[model samples]
Every structure is written in C-alpha cells, then in structure tokens.
Target: MTTLNHYHYKRLQEFCSSVFVKAGVEKEQADIVAASLVQADLRGVDSHGVVRTAIYLKRVEQKMINPKAKIRIEKEDESTALIDGCNHFGAVVGDKALKLAMKKAKANGVGMVGVKNSNHFGTGAFYALRGLKEDLVTIVMSNASQTMPPTGGIKPFIGTNPLAVGIPCGECEPFLLDMATSVVARGKIIVAAQKGEAIPHGWAIDKNGKSTTNAEEALKGSVLPLGGPKGYGISMFIDIFSGVLTGAGFGKYVNNMYENWKAPQNVGHFFITIDVNKFMDIKTFKHRMDLYIRDIKTEPKAEDVEEIFIPGEMESRRSEQRKKNGINLSQNVQRELTNIGMKYGVSLKDALMLNHNTEGKGV
Candidate 1:
C-alpha cells in the first residue's frame, strides 16, 4: 500500500485527464471524468476511483464509449428532462444531466432528469452532492450491467443498481446516503480478486448457485442482494426508473463494462433535485436537521458501538483526514495506474515529484 498526498493525487488527476485527452476526449470533459474519479478516492470510495481508469481507457480504445459524445435533450419541460448520452463516459454525461436538473430546480423548485445510453458514472454520490452545494435535496440513481441475481434465482438477471441522496444541514456536514442494492458492490469483488484475497461468504454465489468465498469465483458467478428479496425489489425498482423509463438497456441487455468491450454499456441514470425553501424555510430545515443529527449521535450506544453516525458522516470525516494524510492505494492499483501513465508517455514517478514537499510512502 502507498499513501499519496492530495497534491500528488491531484497530479494523478491531471495525468488521467491528459490520457483521456490523448484518447480523443475533449479537454474539459476529460478533466470532469478525472476529477470525478479522483474525488471517489478522496472520499474513501476507492472501488469507484482510479482503479477504473484502465477499464475506461480500454472502453475508449474499443470505441465502446465515445470520447466526443454529444449529449442532447430528447425531451424537456419546465421541470423535467430526458437526455440521450450518445454513449458518452458516464461522468461527463452525469455532470451535464445534474447541471440541467439544478437549473430547472432553481426555476421551478423541483427538477427531474432521466439519462439514457450512458456509461458507468462512478459513484452516484458524485452527482447528488452537486445539489447539496446549492442547498437542495438531491436523489440520484443508476443501473449497471447484470451482476446480481434475483431472489432464489440461479443465474444473474439484474444489476447492482445504486441510489444516492444528499441533504444539507445547518451545523453539520451534509447527509449523504449512497449504496448499492447488492450485498456488496461488484467492484469490491473485483478489488478482492485483484488483491488475490478471498471474500466473505453470503456476498456472492458460484455459477452452480452455491455460496463462495473465492473472489474470482464470485466474479464469474453472481452477487447476492443486500437483503435477499427486499434488495432485489429495490434494484428492480431502480432499473425501471433508470433503465426502462429512460429507454436505456435493462436487465440482461445492459452490457458489462469489463466483459463486453465492443458495445456501449447503455446504462441509465436518474436525478431529482428539490429546493428546500419550497417546502419549508431553508434556515428552519437546516436547524431541524442539525437537531436531528445531534439527537442521533448523542443517543445511547449498544455494546462495542463507540458512537452512532449519520449517513455519510463517516465518509466526510474520512475525506478530511485523507486530504491531510494522503490517499492510500493498493499495490495492484498503483501498478495499473503506472502502466496507464506509461502508455500515454507520462511518467507517474515524475508526477509524484511535483509533490516533493509532501510526506508519504508505501507500506
């Protein structure tokens, strides 16, 4: 493991941006994609972070993701919109969709946007947090390639669809809830496989529909839902809104980002923004949220529980700590990033030199 200072991590972003640019992506869009990926790492969501650079780059090379994708509004109204991503990188398309939703929310007090034909959009929180900055409540959802099997099913039929919500408070950090409907995100299994580590039982099932701890077998099989039938229902609900409603690929039709190299992922995303002031005085709402958070944190703790945490509180704390101490990347991730940089004639070692003033090292 190596801890990279924020300064060096920023340089990593710049390097990734450069690589995307060389791959025919627009400079601005490339930067957005890079920032989104790096932000995932900064916030301690390493599964959605730079670990994805190689796959994304490969997708671009395979022409599965259009570097110069032209997203357009397919339908629009005062407070709603439907966007066609034109097979663009998910981060770029997601940014555009969220911005448009914020614009509509500002004017109408609420906004809803559905996006189709997008790629993997990293973490859903990245888009929801946009509304938090504007003092609005935001909800984001997206469908992914098939990886999770429905309750009692043998083979994979649906994705580990995710949901993220961001709500601002007066005196505390914004509340963010971002989660996959599966028992564990597929990326966790991929990371485990990369590190040659075994997974926990109940996380996934082998091809024969038996529980397995081997990460590679899990990947080759199917992930379990978060709460059996309940999670499966939730994932299916998300797919309906993000995939079927948005006219994107649904169920088994969504192409796997890792397995399918030649076809577009055709994933879908949904965003909704609500202006707090419209329902209640913004100040009052914030004050109430702070009070609620206080009560929850100060409540009695069960045995071995140090404290209760509001959703997203721990991640906020992790981000602040990481900003100062630097981000830790696994050796496999480091090697992958280094190889990607070399492919683009950019030396990661040289990039690290840009942050010579910072202190950190591999463990």
Candidate 2:
C-alpha cells in the first residue's frame, strides 16, 4: 500500500459505524461517533479523525467505554445545568449537552452546561458547529488525560485542554476557532509516532526532559504548553471549567483513555450557547459580524503574507475542498482500520477502495 490514499467520507463513516455496531454499539450512537470522526477528517484535523477508531474500539472491548450508557441531566436552572455522561462516548455526551445548552439558550438568551463522566469526545468544534446550525454562538471545551506540563515544570500535570468557539456570521459560514492549549495536540504526536515521522522542535520534550523531535520520545515525555506560562494559565481555566467545575475528573485525577484499562476515563466538557436574537436583531448582528471579519482580514499582511484568514476560515475551506475531493488516510491508519474491521467482519477493501470515476466527488 502507498503512504496515503483517498477515501470518500461517507464510505468511511459507514465503515466506522458498521464496525461499532458489530462490536455491540447501538446504531444511532454508532452513527454519532462515526460522523464526529469523519467531521475531523473533513476539516483537516486528522489527529482527531478515524485514526482514533482503533483506540476507541480497544476501549470498548476492554469495557472502558459504555456504548449504550444513558446521558442524563443531574441538575438544572433556567440558564445553567449539570449533566452526567454515564461514561458514554464523548461525542454522544457532547451532542446531548450542547443540544441542552441550545434549548436553554433559545429560551433565555444564554445557556451553560457542564458535563461529567464522559469519555474522550472528539473535536470540540463538532459541538461548536452544532451551535452554528441554529444561528447560535457556542463555546465548547474539554479536558483530557494529563499530557502537558505546567510552565517551568518537567512533570506532566494538565491536559492539552482544547477549546473551540463557533460564531454565526449569517450568510457566510460560522467563524470557528479550535485549538489545544499545548503547542500541538497530543494526538498529532501520536499520529507522528504511528507514521514514523519526527515532530518539529519546541513541540515536546523527551521523557528525560530534553527537547526532542522524535515522536515516540515526545509521547514518553510531554507536549509543550503554548506560549509557555500563558498557555499553562489557559489550561488551568479550561480544566477548571471543563473538569473541576463539573465535578468530574480534574488536574491529574482523570484516567488515561489509552493506558488505564481498569476504569472509565470520566472525561469532562463545558459548553456555552448564546442566541443571537436575544441580544440584538438578527439582521444587525449578521451585518456587524461581516464588517468585523472584513476589517480584520483586509488589514495589511505580515512579511510575505499573501492573505489573512479569520479564525476557522482555513478549516472551513479545507472542509469544503475535502468534501469535493476525498479525504487522505495514511497507510498506517489504513492498516489499523483494516485490522479492526476484519475483527468485526467488515471488508476493509470494499470499504476503502474507490471507483476512479467517482474519486474526490464526495461519493
């Protein structure tokens, strides 16, 4: 097999969902997980995409994730609520939580929800985009197993702790910002290690605490916090909001989804939804947002910069391109997916092989 090949997103999603169902996940939930993973691939964030399916399946096999676990609200107020994920897949928990927030926001202009006992929810932007569907602005954040160290420290304590925001811009697509507090998401390092690729300097250090470009060494060590202490500070608040505040795992207490076979991850997430009409007329808000984005993007470019992209614009473009042209899956990821599919009785060749005439045509 070559180093890379293109696959239709729908085909990939169906393959993933089938594998999940064969492994005993309900059909609806399986679709949710599959869509979330494919959404990552579509947006060029392959780190959170289908490459994660192997680990996700392993967690299921080990009973670390409850495929049919119930998601329920534990407490609530007009504009605030707390929900328990029941150790379900992270995307499932996030979907329900974000929807609940949206429901509340529709009624009260603003809604906030904290989630507990969740598993690794994929990209936060998945939920952010959900908010965009309803013309709402949403913020989504989550804390993962510790992989980044606090500034000036060698030992890992805080998670990369990702944050994402989606802002509706009316006629244009929503403005999206999604990122990890660490210089790079740990999943990217994992992907590099899987592909035998080296990471760039300043991304991480070896377990020995020396900066290293080797992905495996970086995995053994810790990814660097973005901007040093500033990134560390942002991580603290993310943990506070998505973890501590939710009464879920926090600091170093969250179990690792990869290493901890004895228990559920109990990961946590926080979501905030704002309804545009509640604050201003929808027309005015959209017009103002257009002006705001234009003002920032049309400014003078930095040295050698040809264009400036608003937050999430690049990803949105990547998504549209991938939708028209298929997604790329590395050989290593393909092998793993094939192996897992075989275990579940799905034909990898049938699922991945594409007809040339339909290639990159969103088949």
Candidate 3:
C-alpha cells in the first residue's frame, strides 16, 4: 500500500532549491521555481508540487528547456504587454509576468499581460495569490498539454487549461478560486497511477472512450471536462487568450514536454491585475466584502455539512495547517524525489533531517 510521511515545509523548499541549482539553473531562477512548487505542496495541491520537478530538471538536462533564458517583452502599451519567455522555466516567467501586471495596475488602475514561449507554470493560484498580496484583484490562466477532448468528440484535443482568481476580503480570508477545466488536473492522475490507486468515477475514460476507475487507463484516455461542454468552452477561450492571442502554440500544436523531447513546450499564460482603488477606496471595498461573506456563510447548512467554504478556503486552511504541522508526501512521491536528489549529489534524507520526521495519516 502507498504510505505517507511528513517533512518540514521550509526544509523541503530548501532541498528543492538546492536540487535545481545543482542541475545548472541559476540560483534566482531556481529559487523562484522551487518556491512555486513548494507553495503548491504547502497548499495541498501536490499534483503541481515538487513531484513534477524531476521531469522539469530532466527537460533542462536534455537542453529541451533553457534555464537561463532571456525573458523580454516584445510589445506593450500603458497597461498591457506581451512577453516572450524565451523558453524558460514557467515559474520564473510567471513570476516576472505577475509582478509586471501588479506594477502596471498600481500605476494605471488595471494591467494585463500575455506570455508566450514558456513552460508549464506550476499553478495559476501561485501568481494570483502574489497579486492578491498587493491587495489587487488578480486573474491568472494557462493552456496546458492537450489531454482532454471537447464535449462529445473522442480524440484528445483540448488542454485541462486552468484558471485562477483571487480577491481580497477585509476581515475574512480572501476569496480565491483556482480550478482546471478538466474534472481534475491531469497531474493528479499521474500521481494516483504512481501510487497504484484508482481514480474516482467520472474523472476520466479509457482509450475506447469508456469511463473507468483505472488511473493508467485514464492517463491513456482523456480526462472529462469540468462541467461537460461548459468546461470545454471555458478551456477553448483560455487557449485563445493564453496561446492563440499570445502567439504560442495552441490546441493540438502545443508540445507536451514529456512526450516531445525534440523541443521545449511553447506554453502560454495570461494575467490580469486590477487595483480596487480604481473603483472605490480599499477600506470601503473591504467592508462591503466582509458583509458579503457574512451573508453567504450565514445561510449555508445542508446534510452532513458543518460549515460553508469559499472557493479556495479549504486550500488556505490546508496550507495553514500544513505549515504548522508539516506537509505529507506519499512514499511513491518521496522515493521519486530522493532518486532525483541522488542524481544531483544531494540527499533527500538529509533534507528531511532538518526537522524531525514523523509518521502521519496518509492522504
């Protein structure tokens, strides 16, 4: 059976940073990538966390992706810009794009940035939350490798295509929404398969187009869209914004990094940052948001439901708890991490020793 272990989050982040540096990535770029991955883990989005780092480094090692890529903006207006990532690590590209969006918003009330020639940027929420920290409403989205189909068709075509939005709420936790257009991110299926677990019904189908609980089969087949055709449309628009509009590969053309070793995945990203003061003062907006949250929470009671949660509330709670206690890693994932560390002459065991390890309840 797949087992679990808990390790201190800070130490884990340090270990990840060191691994990338050893893999020949510049320290600044490596740290940004490492933080983004660990942030995913801390928020319990393990599918996008350190587990995926090994593949990223492998891509770097093969020269399919450039670790020291020159990220530059090819075009811009007062509040909008288009960036060429030069095929760098997605997290580094995302970091620069989000910060630029925030800077423009602060000066011009709103900012929008389009990115091209990037790799997989861990999670949209990572950038969204960064903007949220500056008290701006943020929207982040990306088009990924196609592993899903549109409404009724069979062959894989559309990507999971994730979207994330974060807004500040005065007294309450910010309302955060981050989701994949697919029923689940494809990485989750990869994780389940690694752990020898079956996926839940309605998540994906076999190659023959039949719904199946088999994770391996699901990987070979297509993951179902989030709300059937509705999600298909959403994903299509995301691809338009992130890929087509940004001059990056779209639809069937976006390279899957794992499958296509010939070149880097020309992924794309879109970000929007809005300064609330553009509409009303920050204090007034926060006060209204506080009341709005109260209205929603007061009327929420259903069978077996103890509390109502905002879209990203659960993840925030998970992050807080994990930060205090520790993050859990399945034995399968832990082994993958250790194996990667060994290649870089780093010891995962020593990384864990920074904080005492403990047996924990497995997910």
What are the per-residue Cα lDDT tens digits for candidate 1 across 1-363? 223523356777888899888788899999999989988887888899988999999999989998776799999999999999999999999999999999999899999999999999999888877789999899999999999998989799999999999999999878999999999999999999998999999999999999999999999899999999999999999999999999999999999999987689999999999999899999999999999899888999999999898888888888766655566777787788788878887766644522565554321
What does candidate 3's lDDT look like per residue over 1-363, in tens digits?
A: 112366667778888999999988889888999999989998989999989888988999999889878899999998999999999999999999999999999999999999999999998889988888899999998998889998998778989999999999898988899999999999999999998999999999888899999999999899999999999999999999999999998999889977999978999999999999999999999999989988999885998999988888899999977776677788877898899888888777754532354334222
Reference-based lDDT, each prediction: 0.88, 0.89, 0.89
**TM-score of every model versus the real structure:** 0.96, 0.96, 0.96
Model 2 regions lying over 4 Å from their true place = 1-4, 360-363
Q: What's model 3's lDDT at 37?
A: 92
- What is the Cα-based lDDT of residue 138 in candidate 2? 95
What residue pairs clash in candidate 1, if any at all? none
CA error at residue 218 for candidate 3, angstroms: 0.9
* lDDT of model number 3: 0.89
